[model samples]
Each structure stands twice: as structure tokens, then as C-alpha cells.
Target: MVVSTRAGAERSQNITVVRQAPPMSRTVSAAGLGAVGGMVTEYLFDPELGRSRRARLRDKGVRLTHGVRNGTRTVVRDVRNRGQGVLGAARYRTTGREADDEVLHERVRAELGRHVRHPREVDVRVESGHVTLTGDVLDRESRRAHRAVARIPGVAGVDASWTTHHDARRAPRSREDGGPMEALQDLFRQRWSPAGRSLTGLAAAVVWSLSGRLPRPLGYLVRAGCAVLAARAATNLPLRRLTGIGAGRDAIDVGDSISVAAPAEEVWPVLSDYGLFARWMPDVLDVRRSDDGGRSQWRVSGPAGVPIRFEAVETAREEGRRIAWKTTEGQLVAHSGELSVTPEDAGRSRIQVRLTYNPAFGAVGHAVAKIFGADPGRKFAKDLMRLKSLIETRRAPVGAGAGPRE
Candidate 1:
């Protein structure tokens, strides 16, 4: 009796322990969520660029909200249009009144293109709702053309006088002739095409559902695939372009233009003097040009006072007009820049600068830099403003300091 009682007690204890296991899982999940939240907070509230990053996040949120609203409206409109088309089709079938001969001819002609391989070769004529088709057509295509014309809302009869050839090679080819893959590619490229929408929607749904059910690395991969499909559906950009691959991936371009009060000739000296770039260019600490003036080395201050160094060769030069340079091969970061000065009215000049840089990590590095307030585009705009002030006022701007320019 005692042994039986002890065994019963142990069994109850085991049951209680098993029942408690789920809470531990719940606790671990909560901790993971807390860690994620802490990391996000640290990222957005960094000491140096927190305010700007937060502002950017807020702006992006607003834009995303607007996009969602607009997308909803578009979907609703599409559904309404489809419903109207169905109703119109039904109404046309139910009506008994005979359509005019000219109207019936236009309808048959319109329907013929969808069914026939070579619509232009087939001539169409309609008299009292009777459609007459006369042309050289393939034997495989003639029956379909007759049936399609006869099915039109007001088509009474179809008279096919076409010379049917058994061999398709001898018949006239269609303007849209292509292989199956070509057709699919064309359909996928369209932003809001039915096929594209259906495929992306199905893919997104399947992957999203599987992402939660899958485990660890597999789940992560599925989530990434879902994101890529969603983005492709929204933007209609090719995978190569979206992922920053292929030929143009080496050139991430940013540009800005500013007007200066001085003449083009005066501005030319300020721009052409590579040695004095540190004075007006933000973050540039030193510039050293080769004896031939065809090559130059630059030292720039990066985020957290990290030193960035690169060598560039002068690719193009036109006196008082334009200067272009590109980084030497085998560099970690590929960089190229162009500056142009154009004469404007009232003795003014317009200076335009274009810079292209492909970082070591591609688009992801660029995005991270932008988020941390290290965007070269914004820096160049500030540099242009400082240069404009220095040239027009004949001295440094009000808050110019000895350290690297902000």
C-alpha cells in the first residue's frame, strides 16, 4: 500500500513538471522580444545621429502609411472595374435587339485580333450582322477565327473564305510571335498585370505562412524571400537592379547643383585648385596631387574620426568647363566624380557636381551610412553652400572653424 501511494505521488509530480514546461518557453520568448526592442532603441537613439535617424524613421513611417492607403484604393478600384466588365458582358448577352451593321463590323474586327494568329492578313466585312472573313490563314487558325466571330454579341453568321494552308511556316506570322518564356518574361515585367499580381500574391502568401511554421535558418530564408517578392511586386524592378548586381552596380550616383554669384571664369579657379579642396570641402582633411596633375590622393574624416584614404586619376579635363576623376583600380571603394561650371546671366555661374561611389558592401553599406548621417550627397550639398558663401562674401562663413567641416 505504501509503495503504491509513493508511485502515485511521483506520477503527480511528473505531471506537474510537464505542465510547467510551457511557461519556460513563454519566458524565453519574452526575453528574446525584450532584447530585440533594446537593440532597436540603441540603434535609433545613438549619441551622435539619433535625432536625424529618428526623424528619418518618422518620415518613412508616414510615407508607408500613405502608400498603404493609396494601394487599398487602387485594389478597390480594380475590383469594381472587374465587376463592371462582368455585368456588361452579361447585359450584352441578354439583349435581343440587333446591332447596326457598322457596329457589328467593328465588334467582329476587334474580336478577330484576339483569336487569329495573323489578324492583318484576314479582311473583315459585315452586312446585317453577318461577318465575312476572306484571307490566307493557317488551317489550325481558321476554325477558331470562325467560332470567335460567330460568338460576338451581334454576329449573325460567319463566312470563312480564307485559303487554309496546313503548313504554318507558309502563312503570315503574328507581330507578337514569341516563345513561352518570352511571353512570361513580358508578363512579369508589368507592374500591375494580372499574371504578375497573382504570382507575387501567391508567393508572398505561401512564404509568409511557412516562415512562422518553419524553424531557425529555414524560417529566416523564407522571410527574406517573402520580402523580396513583396518588393518586386511593388516596384516592378528586376532582381539584378533591386539587389544591386550586374554592370551598373559599381556606380551609385548622387548629384547636386548650385548657383554662385561669381562668373564662370572666377569659379573655375576655385574648383580646379585641387590642393585647396580641404578649405571648402566638408570632411576633407588633406589633398595631395601628383607632379603631372593627373593623379591625386585624398584623406577624409569619416564617422567617429575614422580616416578614409583613396587615390584617384583624372579621367577628363576641359579648361573652365568640366573636370572628371575616377578612383584607381583595386581599391576597397570605387569612386568617381565630375564637376562642371556653366556661365549664367548677370555675371553668375552654375556649378554642378556629380559623385558616384560603390562601397565594399554595396547598397546595404550606403543605406547604413545614410541612416547614421554620413551620406556623401548631403555632405556635398553643404560643401557647395559653404563654397558659395566663401566665394560671394570673400571670406569663410560665419561659423567656420579649424577642425573638419560638419
Candidate 2:
């Protein structure tokens, strides 16, 4: 039997106070205090408990304890020490909690896959809630992977220190997984429809008529200018219908345009505001953008309010000019689209959205497509009109850092 001190001397007690060595106690660390019936199992103590340290411990459920490590006594005082920056190098160490190991691993991998291009090649390990992402990633992909995992809910922290850059040959493909030439070829082929051909012919005729009135050298210059303009227009015109998938050959091609009173600089922020887009855009429930601003996953409410989800990656972007994205995970929604912001005047800009997606429910979908017309132009026009209304009136939905308009 063990006798206790003070008034409880008559009762027997079993208590073990495990003290760690001094050399290992430079920073704050938590240790198990051994269970004594109803007593706490973990005791976290450090000698210099600054404001930041105390806040970290308090936030993480740590308490103060009067103790000694290796014969050096520790002070147990109020955690009100001041004159310290909040950005101090104060790391809180701990023994991980009881979490489902399998669940943690699955979640980590899923989040990584959603953000990284080649998740199969990446290695992930999870103990309790702490995760380690170690693999060879392409340039800039490693940082994005780290940021993506860190945003997950149950993730306590991610240790990406071991992540390395792969050589060019072995590097993983980016979210935009196709070669530049292939993308360009696809673009040209998609724009080679009957209507596109008609428009190109009309443009050529107009250019020829205007150039014939100019001097010999000026006429040649005019022809060259028209050729450049035609190429640019073909790419900007977003009217491509890829066969097979969605409504099969009867897939939906959507195009819409709106003129906002504000310039692209003011309007670009609203378009990129993924978190609040659902509030303004029709049928969308939420959008989650990955780090590096190159990829995103969208969750939308579908028929009967059922949630439909898809992942997309940015293929190309030109600041204040045009941005294009294509679906990488085409399980639910196979689509590709582009948005262009053209300056109309000093203070106004025109925003155009060209999207082509497969509503893949073959038979019933084809019937529905016939009912809704060959293209989703009307629905898209309505969507863009809503955006124009919101931006022009400065009445965007509530989002982070959004306040009353000036």
C-alpha cells in the first residue's frame, strides 16, 4: 500500500510522475503522466511559458503543472508574459490522438488526388492525425500538394519536408495533362464547324474588300492583319461540341456573354471568388479551388437537389485576358470551357463564357436536349445576365473580405 501526503494520508495511492531528460526538453513537449484511476494520462509542461506558448497549449487542451526535469525546477505562474511577437517559432508537440487510421489515410489520399495530377505515384502515411506526404512532384506541384492537404478538416498537420522535385523526364504531368500542340489541334478542330466556316468566309470577304481599295503594300499589310485577327477570333469563339459522351452526338454546347460596368480588374475578383460563386451562379452549390489557383472541384445541386460533383483544372490563363479550364475527373460531368474578359472602354468590360458539357443520360437526355433546344444558349444567357446584374449594381453575395461597396 502507498500512503499519500497531507490530509489524504490514510488512503492508498498509485501515482507515477515520469520526467523526461533535460537535453530533450528545449521546446514544449507533451508526455504521458500514466493513468492513476481518474487522473489525466498526459501532462504537458515547459519552463518558459510565453503568451504564444500558453495560447497554443490552451487552445490544444494543455494545462500547467509544477514540475522539474533533470533536477531543474520549473515555475508555475500565470501565462500572461508579454512583449513577444505572435509569429514566434513556437511549435506544439504532442502524442497523436485516437483516430481511425484507415479513414485518415483514405481522406489524405482523396484530398491529394483532387489537387495533385498524379496521386497514384505519391506516397501518403497517416499516424493518428499527423500526415506525411513524401514523393517526387513536378515543380510547384509539391507546394500545392502541401497547401491542399493542410486545408483538410481532420488533418492536424502535414510534414512535407521529405517531398522532393522530380527530374523533367520523370516529372508528373500537371493538372493540364495534354501537350500544347494537342490542345491547339483540339481547339482548331472544334472550331471547324459549318457555322465557324461561314463566319471565317464572311471575315475573309470583308478583309479582301477593304484591302483591294488600299495601295499595293498597304493591301498586303491589311491582309496579314486580317489573318491574325481571324486566328484570334477562331480561338475566342467557344462553340465546340465533342461527339460521344453526355447526350452522345447531341451534346449541349453553351455560350453566353455579358457586359459589366466595372473593368476586368474589379470584375475578375468576383469571378475568381470560388467560395461565394454558388450564391450568384445558377445551380451551383459550392466550388473549392486548390492551391496555385490552377485547379478546382465544384459541387452542384442537381435534379431533386441531389449533389453532383466534378473536378476541373485550368489549362491556360492570361491575366485580365482569358482563362480556360477542362474537366480532369469526367466521371460525372465531362466538360471544357473558357472565360474571356475584353476591355470595352476605359471603365467597362465584356465577359463571355463558352462551355461545352455532356449531359450523358443518353436517351432521356437526348429528348430533354431537343426540348431545351440544340444548345444551352438561353440558360447560359440567363446565368451571365445574373452576373452582369450583380457586378454592375455592386451587389455580389457575402464572401470573405467582401463588404459594402464604395
Candidate 3:
């Protein structure tokens, strides 16, 4: 959610927070007793009750520069509010550890993004200048907003020195207070936690491996067998060269496509972001591109109990238009691929992936893909389908680049 403030129009929602809403803040004049009293009263009447104390600082004019929920404590750690101008010695929240400082910034960014209502315009950036804000807000009510953002956990000071023009919209989005302070409420609403489902799948695998239930053999046996096979495969020089399981190998013949209810090119953007590999590739660690060139790398979590290591080498083009590579070196040696984006009608993209891996164990290797196949492979397939769902529906990607590898 975002928080926005236009020049003059009134009708905004609550405070809009965005990106990583951490906490909210405000400044107060130590000398103003009435202002402080008003703030105290406001806190006593808040809805969440958990964050009501935040209102107490509105003492001076008793402002609410921030709308974050960082416990219920008024702090004295800001430089701009220090009265004197050194660092610290002023006012702010103490999250206990300094390492968690980024939380404050993300939180503030979230707050502003999710709550920005019909404001003339809103822009944020960090520069050598006094941190400028050059948009028009609804009323003077938003003046504190600029101050609020400026007094963020680590912010130095404000340069609201920019001029504020006049103009405001009537009804704004609901998440954002009917005002300009709401533009960050749902910035990352698409996030989905796969823990429950992943755990269930793991459990099923366990069950199948232990007691013979369905049409398959015991799960443990398969796993143990796979482990043994993987161990043997890793030690095998030929196998080592095939999958590129350990050594930093390049992905070969990388041809992937999205078969959605739409057409090709729809999944372009998501596919373009090489870093997005983390989100789609299962059991994969980091998918990176060498700064030296377009060559890509995959750090894969080695099969069972093994540490993470380079699993494949890859190369892509047209921002993923044509992705192909070879296993320069892990699990499968001399791997190659040709991923094509064949567009399907009805807004679906038919992504055709032709991957060929040189398996040292040949048939034995095929067995591994068979066991873990249905699910993870299906997951890989499902991600493409997900790419379809998200692409066709024009929805945002699930998480930040990727979720934990399955």
C-alpha cells in the first residue's frame, strides 16, 4: 500500500504503506503540552490498539509523520529532531539491532506505496540533495507526511523545500486512507507461502518410501536407492561430466517456452529477468549471469545431504527469447537445450522446452528423473503453467524473484 497526498482535494483513505512496510513515526515539540495531550488522547482511541501509542507523539501539533507499527515506544534517536544537529541524540525507534535497519526503510517504502491516494504526483529517491519531494498534496495535512518520511529510521532530514502545487481528487483507493498517504497496501499481496504444500508433498514421499501404499514401492527405498545411485553417479567421471552437478557448468541448449491461455511473448518479461530463476527452478540455489558476458550459472542444491554447488551452465538471449546452454561441467554432463515460446491461442502461450542431457548412467539416470519426475518436473511444468496463469491474467509474480527451492 502507498500513502499519497494531493494539493487540495480531501477524500483519501488511511495511510498507504508499500513494498516493505516496517514502521511509522512522527515528531513533537517538547514544549507543547496541549499538542502532547491531544496525541495521548488519539492513541487511546485507535482501532488496532496495538499501535495506538504512536499517536502520543502528536503532542506538538502532534504529527504522525510515520504510520509504521514498531511496537509501542516513543524513541529519541533522530538527528534532524535533535534540536542540535549532530547524529543520533534525536528521536526514532530502536528495533534492538542495527542490522535490522533495512527493515525500517522497506517498511517506510511499503507504507508510502500502499497508501498513496489521488495525489498530483509522488516521487522518492536518495541523493546528495536534502532528499527532495516535489509533488502537490491535498492539504497542509500532508506536510507532516513529507516530514514523516524524512524522519524515517535512518533518514537525516527533509528538503520539503520543493514547492507544493494545489489540486486533489475526491475518492481514492480504499486501502490508502481516502487521502494521499495510501499507496503501498498491496504492493506484494501476491506472495504465497508454499511451506504447507511442500511439507505435505515431502510427507507423501516419506509415506510412499516407508510403507508400500499406492501402486508404487516404499518411498525410503526409492530415496535410498536414488541416493546411492546419485552417489555412484557423482563419483562416475562420465556422469560427472554429464549433469554438471558440482562444477560450475554452463547450461546448454536452453530452450524453454510458456504455453499459456494467451500467445507467445506474453511471458517475456518474467522470463527476461534471469534472476527470476530462483522462483521457478526447483532445488536450485542462485541463477546468475556473469558480469563479463551473457553467460549464466546455476548453483544447485546437490542431491540429498550434499552441500550446494554449481549444477549447470547456461546462456539466454532476447531477454530469454531464445535460451540455450551446455553443461560445461554436474549431475548431467554435456547438457543442452532449445527453449521456444510457441504462442497458443486463447491467450495461452505454448512453451516448448527441448532439453537433452548426456547421462552417463543412461537408463539408471532416466530412473532418477522418473522418481522425482512426476512432482518436481510437474512443478517445473507447473511453473510454466503458472507463468501462463500470471501472464494471461496479467497478475504479478508470486514472490521476490523466487521462493525457496523445493
Candidate 4:
């Protein structure tokens, strides 16, 4: 009986332990949620930039709501139009009615434009539902063009006549001759275009829906794809630009300008000389130019005395005016920079520097660097000001050293 009583006591203890587990888990989850809430509150209600941040958030929310509403309306309208087209096609088939000669000609012409690479070179004419294609055409495109025109809703027959060239270069028509859809595709490939955003947004929605129905690892991949599509749709930026793959005029990550008391000619010498950079440029410990004068290796003092090294090749130089350089291949960081000197009144010169960089971890690395006061933009601004002072005084600025300037 004592043993039985002991077992009952143990059973009660087990029940108590099981009952305690949920409350502990709930407490932890609540604490986590509270921490997240506090962080979000601090981020949106900072002392200096809170108002602007909140306003920006509100504006973005409004824009997103509007975008969703407009996209829904557009989708509904397209569905309605497609349904009408289907119904019309059914009616025509049932009645055995044919389109008018003018309508047929227009349809054939449109089909030719869609199928032919050099639509301008292919002169299309249609009479009584018969399409006649004439003029210079590429042999590769001729069969497809004939087939496309023949398959038109109102086309009765197609007659091909003509000159066909095997090589596009030898063809009479210029390579730039592309149809309407091709032109639209070119525009859609650009960074931000209306058509691109619309198509990408639609694709994102489709992919997002499919992602939920997919299984396991494939589903995870589809989810990632959906995220990429959604980001592209919202930002209207190409994958390369969004990820900071290559440097271009549009990829300028940091830029600043300073006015110097010295003439452009005088400032040009100091700026162009890579050896002089370490003296004025903040955190730049050493710079060594190649014998050919086209490439230079740079060592900049990073956080905790760590050295950041990279090699750059001068891509272009216009004496006393502009200079440009880009990092060599296979570097941890991809970067390019351009400096231009413009003369102003009273022997003053405006020096502008533009730098583009794709560092490790992309934007996250950039943000972390900024938080650590290692942002190149901030350094560039400070360095330019120091350069201005150095040029004007003909001496090194106070506090200029091998380490970063305060």
C-alpha cells in the first residue's frame, strides 16, 4: 500500500511537470514577441529621424494599397476581355462566318509583325483572306513567317515570293529592325519600366501561389524564387543591379563633391597621383602604383587595425579633367571610382568623386559597415575635405595619419 501511494505521488509530480511546460514556453514566446515589438518601436520612433521615418512608412503603405487595388482591377479586366474573345470565337465558329477582307489583311499583317524578325523588310498584302509575303527575308524566318500568317484566324492562303539570305549580316534590312513585341521586351529588360513591373508583379503572384502547393526542398526553392520575383516587381530593378553585381553609371553607390581654393590644373596633379592619396585620404595607409602606371595596389586601415587591400586599374584618364578606375577581377569586393575636376571662378575648382562598390554580403555588409563608421561614402567626404585643406595650405591637414581620421 505504501508503494502504491508512492507511485500515485510520482504520477501527480509528472502531471505537474507536464502542466508547467506550456506556461514556460508561453512565457518565452511572449518575451520574444515583446523584444521584437520594442525594437520595432525604437526603430520607428528614434529621437532624430522618427517623424520622417513614420511618414515614409505611411506613404509606402498607401502606395502598396493602391498598387494592390489597381493590379486586381487590371487582372479582372484582362480576364473579362479574354472571356469575351472566347465567346466571340465560339459564335464565329458556330455561324461559319468569316471576317471582312480588310480585317483579314490587318490580321495577317499583325501576324507577320509578330513572327518576322525584320518585319519592315517583309511587305505583307492580303486580299480576299489570302496573304502574299514579298521582299527581302531571311531564310530562317521565311518558313516561320509563312506558317504564322497562314494560321491567322481569317487567312485563307499564303503566297511566299522572294529573296532570302542565309546570313543576317548580308541581309538588306538592318539588324535593328524588330517587331513591336521585341521592342516591348527590350524595354521590359530595363531597370524600371511600367510593363516590366506589371509582368513581374503578375509572375510573382503566380509563383507565390505555386510555392504553397509544392513539396519540401522544392517548395523552399520556389519560396525563394517568389521572394526574388516580389522584390523585382516592387523595386523594378534587374537582378544584377539589385544584388550589386557590376558597376555602371546607374550603380553609383556613393558620391560627393567639394570646392577647393586651388585651380583645376593644380588640383589635378595631386588627385591624379596615386602615391599622394595616402597622405590626404583618410585611413589609406599605402598605395603602390604599377610600373606601367595603369594599375595600383591600395591598403586601407580597417577596424581594429585590420588592413583592407585591393588592386585597381585605371580605365580612363583625361588630363586635368577626369580619371576613372575599377577593381581587378576576382577581388573580394568589386568597386569602381571616377573623379572629375571642373574649374570655377577665382582659381577655385569643383572636384567630384563617384564610387560604386559591391562588397561581401551585398547590402547587408554595406549597412553593417555604415554602422561601424566604415562606410566609404563617409570616408570619401572626409578625405575630400582634407584634400581641399591640404591643397589650399600646401601642408598635411592636422590629425592626418596612417589610421582613420576622427
Off by over 4 Å in 2: 1-250, 361-367, 370-375, 397-406
Task: Return the candidate ranking by lDDT, descending.
Answer: 4, 1, 2, 3
Strongest candidate by TM-score: 4
Best by lDDT: 4
lDDT of 2 by residue, 266-350 (tens): 8887765667566566577778999888889888766656778988888988876888888885357777888888778869998
Global lDDT scores for all candidate models? 0.76, 0.61, 0.48, 0.77
| Residues 306-390 of candidate 3: C-alpha lDDT, one tens digit per residue | 5454434555554535666655542433555555565556766666766655433443454466565433345556556655555
Task: Score residue 373 of candidate 3 by CA lDDT.
Answer: 44
Tens digit of per-residue lDDT, candidate 1, span 1-406: 9999999999988874334356878999999999999999997999998889899999999999998887777767777787797798888877833689888877877776776666777888888877788887777777877887788887778889878878756766534462111123534563455445546767897879868978889998988888878766755655544455551424356889999999999999888888767777757778899999999998877657787898989999999999999888865556788989999999999999988776544555566678776776787788889888877887767654355644
Per-residue lDDT for 133-187 in model 4, tens only?
Answer: 7888777778887777776676678889857888777877648546434334523
Q: How far is candidate 3 from the true structure (C-alpha RMSD, Å)?
A: 33.8
Measured over all alpha carbons after superposition, the RMSD of each candidate to the real structure, in angstroms, is 8.5, 34.9, 33.8, 7.3
Per-model TM-score on C-alpha atoms: 0.56, 0.36, 0.32, 0.63
